[model samples]
Target chain A: MTAAQPATGHDHVVVAADVNGVSVTEPVPTRWTLAQFLRDRLGLTGTKVSCELQVCGACSVLVDGAPVSACTYLAADIDGRRVQTVEGLAARDQLHPLQRSFVEHFALQCGFCTPGFLMMAKALLDRNPDPTEDEVKEYLDGNICRCTGYEPIVAAVLDAAKRMRGQA
Target chain B: MVLPPFALHRPTTTAQALSLLAEDSVPYSGGTELLLAMRMGLIRPTALVDLKRIPEMQEIRTDRSRLLIGAGVSHDRLATDPLVEQHARLLAAAEREVGNARVRAQGSIGGNICFGEPRSDVATVLIALEAELGLANSAGERSVPAEEFFLGPYWTARDATELLTAISIPLPCAEGVYLKFQTVERPTVAVAAVRRPGGDYRVVVGAVGEVPVWADYPGVGEVDPVDLVGRTSPVSDLTGSERYKRHVTEVYIRRAAELLAESER
Candidate 1:
């Protein structure tokens, strides 16, 4: 479901990348953002787009294990890199530990910012398996959550960190 | 917003990149700033010469007493790199907090300087460290002191046909502290105060003004916060009023000096 028919023309560059363990090669418009490529072309709506600037982390995704604002990131730039979106977090019907913690902790009310929060938290945990509360806060500073007041979300990440570290 | 349609060129060498540079063609690295500017309609280059593939621009090394940092190195890499940590620790500390994790991961130090944003933490630190910027064109290469490289807000000394290649910091470099007062995404005022190996001190205050303002002191005791504040004409914007920024700049300069003095003790 990743690779597409090779498009040949100006203003288009073919991008071959790994999306959620699936290899995708598609000809994307040079100006198309990574969020557009994921949501529009690939039908991966788990990644949202807001603010359109890098200010908001609504479209946060990991490129080679580093979080980037997909809204400002060019789709062509994802070529030859491994991209992980929120849609890639689960296995079969089992939710990721961070996902479980979010739900259990009432981390989402509007749910608009969940996917971004999950993805950003995942990036942080992947880098630092055991982040202090302040470290988690600092790492997730770019993201905005209007509904949850951010307290529960921070608690969920801490709880998830312990769960992942086998301390829960 | 979609970027205006433009041809993308991936050049593997500086020569190839230089040949493609023109008034209409721009050197692009992380696209952290350039793409944003393009999408905002502030700039619309007909083509982008991607500099990531140029291997020469990705290196960080030392030549004699100077630390040579390739322009393409990411802020995150610079923050964690042992060489940067050992040589330019102040730059490393500032880079660690520039924007956020995503920005550090994607934005390049060279791109930060080349963009010449008034609120740039990198520019403030480099100016205090007395770093030199390397620029290249089809003709030749030249180095500009970091202080003179930035002309004004979003303006630099780099020509349309030139590309920033590397940053050179003369070693036994100034060691010190960088303090900033930020109420928003960018800093309201950034101050870098450092004592050079020769025992002279420098204080650079940025973010509040169109360009960074600096003053040299033979000794830390001679550093005047009032005189340093007088050198800047801070723009009154959402961050603060001109008078407010001047006050903050003076305070941060004094604080940075105090911290540097304490650390040196």
Candidate 2:
């Protein structure tokens, strides 16, 4: 009784979203999560869904510059909104400052949850270019990393913020 | 996808939304809680009336001493809205104590209160502040005091046909704070206390009872946190034993009261 099978009789919703600067409109199952739409429909596999529940930060994505748990956010509701996934962080040739800093500081081990961390960290830096260590720790209460004791992830975010502000 | 298939209804106005309501229809605010429950197959509503498009329910309007908080306001908005920060600072502080930045960005005050989750920090503060809830339905709009809104965990006075539109908080302008014991998104034991100069004293203890209990605060400068424990009847869950939760509830109450008292001087 716990595992939910899809409700059989349903129509679909048309979702038009600006994903990573590309605009697309597609008919989606009303129940499909934003994470699923990103990974399945658009084939943007960078957004990972580790714990489908919002508990894990593995599926964090930015909707209009605010970090949201994409696994729980419905694709149908994201209409007319801009969604930025980890795939959008980098240009064709250059890595985003956050991505470069993550690589420079070796922030990931399994590399599965890196996208979520990057996007969440991006929002944090956008608001406060220089955050205290405790502030960063508190802001990331929902985004969890099972590897590296989070020291390097914290260091990488600080470094990225410095690089973004041109203070590095 | 974890969520069961359903039709999505987007209505721009409250009356239009009310017209679309049915037994199997559920109102979607931020979809933070609704989507989570839907994914687990716990709730299978046939249709979801998305409330985000309703402009009337999205304003945080300040009229003199009272502030009308739209139910559609996200947790982050409640936490940082300038009017909330200036007028109902304690409620603002409580919003911050909710889930982290990510959760706050998507969770709405309406869902938080309408869902009537006993462990919700916002609910505790609202009860302590003597807040009133604005509920709309096919008939008309009515106001229910925050104290009378909750019946139990996951249960509220608003029927399926009714929608929670806004929350009105009387400007207590009191020195107040909400303190909680938590290891995750929900609090294990939370307490909200407010002390207004030459006005009133109130306290609410939660996460330990069926619904957060509003305790009778003793007069000015007199506080015994242990007194709240008896009123709450702390329930034992994964967080701790019943006795332990009761103890922590007392501790947090003490801390909250101390903060209130210190501000009075």
Displacement of the residue B255 alpha carbon in candidate 2, Å: 1.5
- CAPRI-style grade of the A/B interface in model 2: acceptable
Consecutive 10-residue window with the lowest summed lDDT within model 1 chain B = B1-10
Give me the displacement of residue B216 in model 1, in angstroms.
0.5
Off by over 4 Å in 2: A1-10
lDDT of 2 by residue, A61-105 (tens): 999999999888888767788899998999988999999999999
lDDT tens readout by residue for model 2, B155-184: 999989999988998874655777888987
* DockQ, all candidates in order: 0.52, 0.45
TM-score of 2: 0.95
Over the full model, what C-alpha lDDT does candidate 2 score relative to the true structure?
A: 0.83
Query: B1-38, model 1: which lDDT tens digit per residue?
Result: 67789888777799988998999889888889999999
Score each candidate by Cα lDDT. 0.90, 0.83
Q: Write the residue-wise lDDT of candidate 1 on A30-63 in tens digits.
A: 8898999999999999998888778878889999
Over 4 Å off, model 1: A1-10
Model 1, residue A151: distance off in Å is 0.8
Task: Categorize the docking of model 1.
Answer: medium
